[model samples]
Target: MAKIGINIATGSLQQEEMIVGIDLGTTNSLVAIIHPESKKPVALKEHNSSSLVPSIIHFGEDGAVSVGETARNYLVNDPANTIFSAKRLMGKSYDDIRKNASFFTYKVIDDNSDSLVKVQVGDKFYSPIELSAFILKELKTRAEHILKTPVSKAVITVPAYFNDAQRQATRDAGKLAGLDVLRIINEPTAASLAYGLGIHKEDEKTIAVYDLGGGTFDISILRISNGIFEVMSTNGDTYLGGDDFDHAIVMKWIREHGIDATQVEQDKMLLQQLRLKAEEAKRHLGQKDVFIDHVGKYQLQITTSEFEKLIDPLVKKTLEASERALKDAGLTTADIDDVVMVGGSTRVNLVKKEVARFFGKPLHASLNPDEVVALGAAVQAEILAGNNKDFLLLDITPLSLGIETMGGLMDVLIPRNSKIPTRIARQYTTQKDGQSGIKISVYQGERDLVKDNRKLAAFNLTGIPSMPAGLPKVELTFLINADGILVVKAKELRSGVEQAIEVKPQYGLTDEEVESMLMESIVHAKEDIAIRSLVEAQTEASQMIDTTVAFINKNREYLEEAEIAATTNAIDQLNQSIATGTKDEIQARIEALNELSRPYAERVMDLAIAKAMKGKKI
Candidate 1:
């Protein structure tokens, strides 16, 4: 009854059989579904539970991984193996991680190819994408259980400041999870959708989404009208978030304890506990003014006002970001119609007050600070699913995309803030006499130095005949689609010699790596199932043996020799299967073995319960 279909008009998926929306956040990730019957969005939760899953993953002894809420609990005891706030490293290079290593609890391993941030979970190493997929899988499992159907298609949201490689990495992650990502919408844009603002139909109002979440900050200005929501401009730090606020508080606590601030990672477990307490303290202060004494393995006390003073600098940084967003939109503070605050970090009373003072307008508190982005993503999912009849939203590239020129300079092709699905073309020439080959380097960012920016890809333009310098003119065309990914082409103007250039991103994982990782995951899943079956079978065999022994002892007088032999034979067969190579194969045998001797096992359980009840009566 469910199928994947594309919209011929919009050039994106028209609708999917399971058109779910996911807000893959820095602190948390959520999966929600729009009820076809009720036409309302409902976030999926685990069975027999109403609480949302936390975005944390813990790898215990023996390659065991616990995701979500359980993983957060594991963090209290195990700091090295518990990975939280992983969304901060998504799409970032190892160099970038190195630059900010002082702030993180996990170690960024740069010796690995392409420099990966490896979380030492127990004895294993995991990439950020791998940890994120664990969270995604947990969400997927909950959704499938609630819907009683497999969910394969989704609309995922990312920070608006994400560049091409980052967006591509996200898509790759969805693929790794066996999901057909219909589209990647910007988080702020999704928040606007949650507001149900009139901007979608073109009201010509300038709206800003001040989004500061667990690990990233993004502020986007949008022009809404006639059902088209266009992002005018955007800017923010990918590594900024409430996590930093917690760190600031923890730093103050460390200073109070007479510990050097630079040695936070030396005793990671202690620092982790302090961070957890600091986070709790910040959340409590949002609702009340008093400070709580948070005693971990070590004693520490923090006041609410002191905590605010420590985070005051970070707050100012965000205010500066808001100013930049307004400036980029070519508008003053007065031009902002309504500032919509999103992200859990915005829950702080100080943050709200500061925003109001800076914008000089009352903050619109109508949207759920924690869930707006996810809700907006669901609305977009409905539209993509062909269920929404109201309007469509269009977003633009967040940065200037260009190619490299002579002397390592960048030649801007499509400037930032260009409408979706735009194209640009440029010409190149032979630089020397008898030049037989040419090279083109494509890049992205607003930097003057090519080395300072992101290298999207590079391809060689070869087979040019021996010619005088500057004689051969090769026209290069760079095209950016609605999703912000790029495609480049080169054609000789005079001879019409042309070729499509394949530009590999400078810092992103290659297709080969993704494929290898996926294959490894399938193998891991298979091994897990086998191990679980073995454990289950072994437990069942032991239980059957114990039951048979007790039953024989209790009814020795009535038990026939034939019945005793049959029970012993069944238990032996199950034990043999547990010892064999294939656990699932053996587990299947255990089920059959149990069926053969059920009367004996059931009778034993009943007798045991009767004995317990008899003792209670006595």
Candidate 2:
């Protein structure tokens, strides 16, 4: 009774409509879809091109953006403009990355304050969301070019340990790429799905996924029962992966040939060449007994045994992480029904053997490790589209439902493509001293900032007893009934004050408007990001000014005439910058104010402490 559509080019079956699956990996990315006739997942690739698209982005002198292999070539030539490993920065603040900032070649804007990290490229600022969107956009275009039809929706996979903010950022990246991200599933779950570990309704298995990618490694233990997959625990090193293996080989050559370390460090091109050659050697050793190559007239050779010996410690590190994951999951190797091997690094014979030995069983790696996650994503897409009977959520929310918080950011409670009749709740607190009220603004859209999204409804929960900032615990709840109605409720637990509102969250927009909003977000991503950075900086500056004024007013007697005059001047300067200055200028002024007031503030604190201890007991 139903007509099925098949993609003429790649044969992706369409049940009503087609949806693709994407693996947005840290080092590489790819797209996959279910084959129309065979009904099996396959990674899509153009003739003569590898399905793996390097997750790299390059900004040209003319302001054009390039992704994948083309961008990868510029990593050394134009390190300042090429962005890679952006996945590590998603949802991370400046303080989270300062210690390892040098790992990135590009300039990461460090405000020294806890703000979302950004990349400064040629006077323009870009967020990790924008950088990742460029890669997703490329994948979308490549899929469209192959399928000969528009690809507008996808299910993207993230690492099992990704938090709520990271997951939402990935969704926003998809929206910016013009894809209605159907879901953000865990990588381990996708890997299990790719291996058909949980496809059947009766299948019950506890699987472990060992994912060793180009630059990082993760081991996830999962529990699957009745076709539902849950990630029990995830553990791994963010710095250990194939890249480390390559570096091990590189260091070997350096020590063997007596090459000057300083020389290699000075010459970026030569260093990159050596690394590439090392990578090539690592891949070659996977298929051959030995790898023989040359990097800039220096002979490079490594037997499989030698290579294995060099990386045995690295492999053990993964096994250690697996044990930790198993321990955290409250399981053991004997309990794991299947061990799914993922990532190109797993293709190495030594890695496969060590993992199998550690698990006391053979590994499941029939599918291409690099493509497995994407293929699993295709299965998820099929399920989400109602093409598969094993899983069904007939009525769903078309867009994400979220509430706006401080700095005008949207924190999504119910993501897009979520099943209906969902109830979700998150806690919040006041941002200022003695604040007695909190406003909950509901929004529906895919943009990161609330201003770019459409407001659904708003309500205030007042009568909270005055308390210092962050002392009041306010809980917000969103309940979407099966009838497509949304009820937003807010309650201050300590004060027992509450408010509720019911409204149709999808009332205002047509399908065209939704698509246009996504397109507009992509078109104005740069401007929107710049404005957001400025607004965030201004907000921080304004708060600093207020705090500084309060301190001055309360402690004018403890301050000298010169100290009071200097503090006032700093406050006025910060205010002026907030009124009319760029994000960088505002941040700079805030730093200056903090520096100028640090001495006086410390002096006042010491005076108070001394007064308090003046006549206290020993």
Candidate 3:
């Protein structure tokens, strides 16, 4: 008799069969999946492991990396090499973060340019993207170990207020971690899904999601209609969250104990210990009326009421953000059908009471606030995998659609797996001085370089009035209709020069071929991204050199002989570095050049302004 074959490892299941959902958060990260037996979304975990992974990474003397709880242990001992809060650097330049640079203990490179920022540890330089990838890779490994299966595809959640560049950075990090990111959903949307708000086709509701995480806060207003979720508005302070709440307690403790704040600041180990104690006290106060503790000779004691008072201003700030979101959405508090709480901070009694009072309704706190987003992402992943047919799964673009930009980089307009019948437009500017025409080349694939992707069509937007670089504003729009046909349009707003083209995005590609292309993209994702970064560095270096040359030529009379010679030497070093140096080397030279030229440029600008006002009346 032929007996039924039984597989001991996976119970007849094959590896690489499940798609997980990931919450790539600022302070922590987690992965979840739909349980095969229960048909419910659950965060993947083991008896010895945890659902949440502290989003931290540390580099050792030997250049080995550690992540999660293990890496978190290095916060005090190896603060310089232990990285946290890297998410704040995503898609930001040095100028954007200069004011807050003191918050980080590690050295953040200040190039004083518009180029993306980098962090330095010892002799190595790391971008936010690369740091974030280390965290993602850890989560991926954890999920795979827990599931006993290879996890390749994922649905990742981001803050609703993240701009296009921030979202793209997140996608690149996921790709670098060897995961094929199927969808990039908003955190608030994922929270709503976890509460089953948009699963029914006939359901219509408006909800407010108040997400207060460890390091950031965001309030998003969303409307759900017929299984579709749309973000109406979002408002919040990226630098405010539960961390500040803990800080309040720490300060109060220091004041009561007569401890020197400066002394605490100088001792990293003491500061980290106090922070941990403050966090512990906060959690204890959540369940009890008061918390009392001691650190050395300092006695820390606080009542729930006092804690509430300490955070009242912070809570008020959140309410103000929520008010702004509601006003931006053109809605009143009464229009909100549900109020969902997300993040561990929302578990505080004061937060709950204030949120309920403001909304005029009891909050939806039934679900675990910390894990709601991850669970919701799992539901979306299930839908993407066709495991949940009861919910509507909109048609998605088979591959990423983008246009070629300077340096031959494929700037994605619409990412893969985006819902169909969508429209998006972005503004662009000329790269060359007095440029009159712009070439728009559309492509379809996942690679960073346009040459690696399949070119769909090419068109030139001619007749644009000649304008200086960065002067003329050109709006490019991509509209994908119901039938999956793409219409690309370009309009120079200043000149009113318009051009458009229609193309069937899926022309000549079979389903098998599409799958093959996707697999190829995932397999080569790392190298593609590395090449893209190098090319971007090269392009930026070239632009800086050109700008410096133009400035020197135009202001030859204003510069001192020594200043001109110094600036010229710096510019030459930058050019040479661009030729053969690493990305970090090129960036270092760029910083040197900028440092030498900034004061001169400002002096010239002041002179021009003074001359213009010389004979004018006040």
Candidate 4:
């Protein structure tokens, strides 16, 4: 007999429904929950297995999918099909990550548009959200297997620097995983909670959380008071982390052994072996003075001092970022009451020693660095579940609020459980030339399709100056006040045309209705996402058709008859694909059309630019 789900120290019962806390990370992801027997947060895993799940995905030849360690195994051998670091691509468009696309081993679809980036595996295309969902699904399955219960709700954490689009992308991923995301908190906040730093109302202090993971480093200064944690400023390098430390070791060995870099680059398996050995050497040197290993006849050896020296600059880079963060927050080292350590990289002795020397305080490293964020997420989940009554929240939105998108899909502007008196703004554009008016329709629900949601309000902002499609930027801002009054504002930033509407967001929906809506969303998550994908594909295809037709009409005089006929034929093919193709088919046809028109399109643009620059000096 055990006192499960009870706060032993407080003599209060915790929620019966288990809400797991998740750390959806760039290199690794894990799930944690309050161990009912011990009444303490713990990362969940099977007997003798490590808690971490690699944030990687692989698609089989038959199109079957695998995630975590299973997928990590394919990264070297089948690099073309294995996808990793999807967290970096979350909410990013092709233009955003095009420069860094080579970092990923898999093929990222180059739609060359502002829409979110997608990964291609053979004939299949996957969005970052979908890729992340696969990882979450694996985590959920692991949690259920270990806990022997159905885990449906979770509180996921992201970096403090994550933007609204990235956060919303995470929420959508959770939904697609069939989990009702209770809340999305910052990783630093979670790390602080894991250390029990901000649970008490009287605990007023400013602490610095330094998180250095496999692929990124972040330093966040948080001010805690009255059980609320506010991030004053966050700064870090997205590309500097534990992996760089490993690479530093690898380079030392490579230089010593005189291994040809070109040969390693040509062989993916050899490169992976070297990288893996380097990682092993890094860990080995952590406890021992020296590491000795071999990677396919290449002797790998590095002293702890050598390892520390190589990574000194990278660690210094993180400290430099910390300095910038403190400066941005208007604080000094003396002002930081506590320095909390986070991420697996902090396990390195040099990293810990340098940080302590700089901060002038003993670091908080009692808890497992790898599991700190997930454990803190569990604490946040407990708080969200009303199990821990240490804090209270203000009036919140029960259902998600969003506007309708191109495919009758609900594009959530404000997610549920968001604290009111908040504002969110998103940029949109015209679909056709001289489109003088754009309708703004708002809805409230958890469903993906707008038809399944409750319409809150609608309005049209007219008198937009006539311009070609996609030239005018229409920014929609949603302002929700303390009284649950939602003010919707649509402004064409270029034209200076604006409109606003005030609506009572809460139309007297009962608790049961809210509960029912949430439950339905989870139950229908997969099908809803499938429908959303199809509708979105169609919408994109239709827009491409319109833009291409417009381009042809405007530049007809500059084109040859054969080029015009080829463009027309490509358009027809795309249109037919939109009518009868699956999402992948539609995308392939779109790419084909793009290839057919890109040459002349670029030439026309160059001529236009040349004419505009005629007789003009630099």
Report the C-alpha displacement of residue 248, candidate 4, in angstroms: 1.4
Cα deviation of 617, candidate 4, in Å: 5.5
lDDT by residue (1-618, candidate 4, tens digit) is 865664444455554588999999999999999876687999987778999999998898987899998888888778898888999999899998888888887888787688888887887788898999999999999987776667999999999988899999999899999899989999999999999999888899999999999999999999998888899999998889999998887777778888898887897688788888888888888799988878777767789888888999999999999999999999999999999999999999999999999999999998989999999999989888787787665567899999998879999999999987889999999887789999999999999999999998999999999998889999999989988899999999997999999998586899999999999999999899888988888898898888888889999999999999998998898889888989888888888888888899999999999999999999
> For model 2, which pairs clash?
11-36
lDDT of all predictions, in order shown?
0.69, 0.87, 0.89, 0.90
In model 3, where is the ten-residue run with the lowest total lDDT? Answer: 6-15
Task: Quote each prediction's TM-score.
Answer: 0.62, 0.84, 0.94, 0.95
List candidate 4 stretches off by more than 4 Å: 1-15, 505-507, 609-618
lDDT of 1 by residue, 1-618 (tens): 777554343344432367788998877888876756567666666556643567788877877778887888876577677788777777676676776776665555443123234454433445566567777777777776666666777788988777755665565466456565667788877887777775245556778888888887787888776766668888777778898999888877777788775676676677777888888888888778766675554566676788778878888888898888888778898888878899889998878888889999998776567777777788888887666766654565545567776556555676544557778776677645677777888776544345645677778877777776668989889876655567899887777767786443223656575445334434343343234335544554555456556667877655568877876776677677657635444545544555655665567568778878984755
Task: Determine the backbone clash count of candidate 1.
Answer: 10
Off by over 4 Å in 2: 1-16, 406-410, 420-427, 444-459, 463-541, 544-618
- Best-to-worst ranking by lDDT: 4, 3, 2, 1
Off by over 4 Å in 1: 1-16, 36-38, 46-52, 73-81, 102-107, 111-131, 198-200, 253-267, 294-304, 393-488, 491-618
- Which prediction has more favorable lDDT, 1 or 2? 2
List, in order, the clash count of every candidate structure.
10, 1, 0, 0
Q: What is the lDDT of residue 503 in candidate 2?
A: 81
Residue 486 CA error for candidate 2 (Å)?
6.2
